[model samples]
Target: LPRRGADTPSLAAKRGKIARFYLAHASRANNWDLVDLSAPYIIGRWLLYPDADGKLPDRGILDTLASHSDLWHQRIGIVATLALIRQGQTADTLRIATRLLDHRHDLIHKATGWMLREVGKKDPGCLLEYLESHFRDMPRTALRYAIERLPEPQRLYWLKRQ
Candidate 1:
């Protein structure tokens, strides 16, 4: 929610300005807390909803972030999916999560797994279906985070798949 009921372009402009600043300084603000705090509410939310002009959200920005060599940028991209998850919009999260499944960093793994867990909260079948297909290749930390909410038996089943 940028401005609740109002489609004020000034706020939109401000948001854009903030995004630009972040894009430039993401490396300096490489701390996990900083990325987690802002990317979701600002970047991710912008990707899911129309602004004042009623323009459709552009997902290409996410693709850019995901494909970047910077770890924080990639984390920002995956964690930004939190906005979609909150709105019962898990598709983007799922799509982005898949792209980072084989990532080498634990931060990406935890973020991906956390997003997957959130997706399970909204749609268990969706998460289960994904895990069923990719659990073996998934990192142990990620698999643990992703299956944290499942039943004991189901959790065991997924973990054993490793």
Candidate 2:
């Protein structure tokens, strides 16, 4: 169970401990809102910080979550990358999206496509490039979500693509 109070820990050690606790308990993290609220702070922030070797955290964390037996964990994997996306980092999102391409869950599809739509918001060209290359195989719900903000003509072009 996560701490649900308004009391903010002022010590670095406490915050670190809390973050670690979140990571350890992620498998038990059920529900979309729970994941959406917690993942960015724990997994996302952890990945943003480089380690002793000056090497960035392994984004394979997302991949691990993507492969979890739990569907909630899978959502955590993708949603956690939201922190990275906020910092203008997108590769992990794209990589995770590719891995979840065949995911059967509507929640997974929505989450993946939401991230891609976010990518489009940041760099439409990049989204266009991705869509051009992979839209054919993208699930319709995901495709619709990803292109929700695109201009009508371009959106139509992609939709009608053979």
Q: Write model 2 residue lDDT over 1-162, tens digit each, in one string.
A: 124544232433444556568768987788888888888788887677654454566788799999998899899899888888877888998888888888899988998889899888887888889888889789988898889999999889888982
Per-residue error at 136 for model 1, in Å?
Answer: 2.1
Global lDDT scores for all candidate models: 0.84, 0.81
lDDT of 2 at 132: 85
Find the 10 residues in a row with the least total lDDT in model 1: 48-57
| Candidate 2 deviant stretches above 4 angstroms | 1-16, 51-55
Tens digits of lDDT, candidate 1, 76-159: 988898988988988788888878888999999998999999999999999999898888788998899999999999999888
Worst 10 residues of 2 by lDDT: 1-10
Using lDDT as the measure, the top candidate is 1
How many clashes (backbone N, Cα, C below 3 Å) per candidate? 0, 0
- The CA-based lDDT of model 1 is what? 0.84
- For model 1, the superposed segments whose C-alpha errors exceed 4 Å read 1-3
Residue 99 lDDT in candidate 1: 88
